[model samples]
Target: MSESTNLREPHAQLVMAHGWLLRGRIWQPLQQQLEPQWSCWAPDLPGFGSAQRPPGLSPTLPAYGRWLAQEAKQRAAGVPLVLLGHSLGGSVVLHAAALLGDQLQGIVLLGCGGGVYQRRPFARLRQVGCALSWFQGDRRAARGLLLNSTQRRAVAGLPKLVSQLAMPSLWIGGGNDQVMQPVYVRHLAGYAPDHQIEVLPGAGHLPMRDQPAALAEVLIPWLQRLASPRS
Candidate 1:
């Protein structure tokens, strides 16, 4: 009954993807708010917090997207998964959805609005991130994550990701999020005609940490609507 198998499977309830350098636990609080009504699956992608980089694995954005598609498929036993991704994870799942096709019920991007970066700033930002990751270890795990995060290869696919998607897409941003503010979120929303935008007022970059209750309120209703028979 798995989506990965030859047989077409039923729709998945939901699956969550965390941002870069983070573990599956990132979705714990969110899960707590929505559980009993719905269950969530959060994977620790390779080279992130608790997950080690697999040997010889390509650490590019496209590679991560393909990997997440498989992971979501495995968890989606006969059901189209309602996919949610945070920051870098959001972008990753966008690419993942391209592969998932009808197996995905819908897509939600939290604090990650896709857009092309200004060349000079993006390069400098990438350099800074890589430097910090290099400071973390000699294995270069962090560096790879940072690279995929800010690379043009990732942004290059946004139009394609949006164009090919046929499901409802939601873009949620923190009102106070300096990293990906409303302007940035707005930019991301424009790319996908099917997307709905929600900015959590008074919430910062990590709304799950800064204002969990409010974040839950914003998220739960949309999910319920999705699960309803009317949807």
Candidate 2:
């Protein structure tokens, strides 16, 4: 985790959502950047981080979304809030924002997946093989899921909903991100034409780790814009 900083002075509330296989602390770098201007809250997913997984709960994405929404609502208390989500968190945020509606000021999606693209049959087979391998303690399986197109499709419904979202949003992508390919970014732009996209050159899937400063530079401006009242 990045060094802790004073957040009370920012006067703006923030909610952060982490990517898969990662906990809330994975947002440390991004949090550090926004702390000067926002009081940030990063929560662990139901089954990940410090949060205990509910027994018999389905591990599907919608279940995660519902859990996150309930948690964010308790934390937000109807205050206008800023939401920043990465990868899996991106889908979670989309669902939460749809539920929160006008209560949320804006949303930022980093290295998000889900698109109209379809994976080949062989690719699906490969993904299942890799998932099984990972279950069997193959470290390579972890890397395979991170790079698979099938995983991207699993969350495609998110962007469709986000497109109709009334609030402003910023869609950021790492220039070299393998997980959410450049084409996916374009697809996102097509869906949410009102939103802006920031591409960090030479960065990868984890831009918060690879390019913290760049992420902050883009994020700060968007947050400020959101805070400003429209004429």
Candidate 3:
């Protein structure tokens, strides 16, 4: 379907928030897979993709979270909205879920941040490198920096806040993800014991890009189950 097609009107609205530095187009493959059953809205986060950065904001995760919350509130409008966020977008959805409360039906976190708090010293250097890349107008670099930063900030507090997240959640991880790592995924599983976890084989940091069909195969069923009437 064309980018202009409104995916929020008739079917269940699937809000697919992209990771840092990437545009909404990242979701195109998955969107195509879901087709008419799921209308996808993948909006660019502030300061990234096609979305403009808000004035005076630091373009940090918290700032993005607030902006996303407001947008979801306005656009969701009582619809059964399901949130699927990648990397930094994962962390954004977490904060948005907290802010939106009952308005959200479920959340899917793909190669998510906020899974582990501490990292090796080189990880810090990686972060520095990412920041430098952003200054050079490299969005992919900026995205990496954002994901790393979000993970660092949210990891410590995530367990506590996750307990308060009553929404049914799903965590998708790349088995070969060098960035987030399997240890982090294990930590996430322990934190949200009730939530489902799926690991994509042969996938990297961007599982949606690497394994769109695999991701969708896992995601669509969960969305449908969540949409079903509860006993």
Return the top candidate by TM-score: 1
Residue 221, candidate 3: Cα error in Å is 1.0
Against the unseen true structure, what C-alpha lDDT does each candidate score?
0.75, 0.71, 0.72
In TM-score terms, candidate 3 sits at 0.83
Ranking by lDDT: 1, 3, 2
| Residue pairs whose backbone atoms clash in candidate 3 | none
Local error of candidate 3 at residue 61 (angstroms): 2.1
User: Which model is ahead, 2 or 3, in terms of TM-score?
Assistant: 3
Q: Report how far residue 163 has shifted in candidate 1, in Å.
A: 2.8
Residue range with the least summed lDDT across 10 consecutive positions in model 1: 3-12
State the lDDT at 28 in candidate 1: 81
lDDT of 3: 0.72
- What is the number of backbone collisions in each predicted candidate, taken in the order shown? 7, 0, 0
lDDT of 1: 0.75
What is the C-alpha lDDT profile of model 3 across 36-119, one tens digit per residue? 768678887766665666565555566667777788777877777788888768777877777877778888888874455557
Predicted model with the maximum lDDT: 1
Off by over 4 Å in 2: 1-11, 121-156
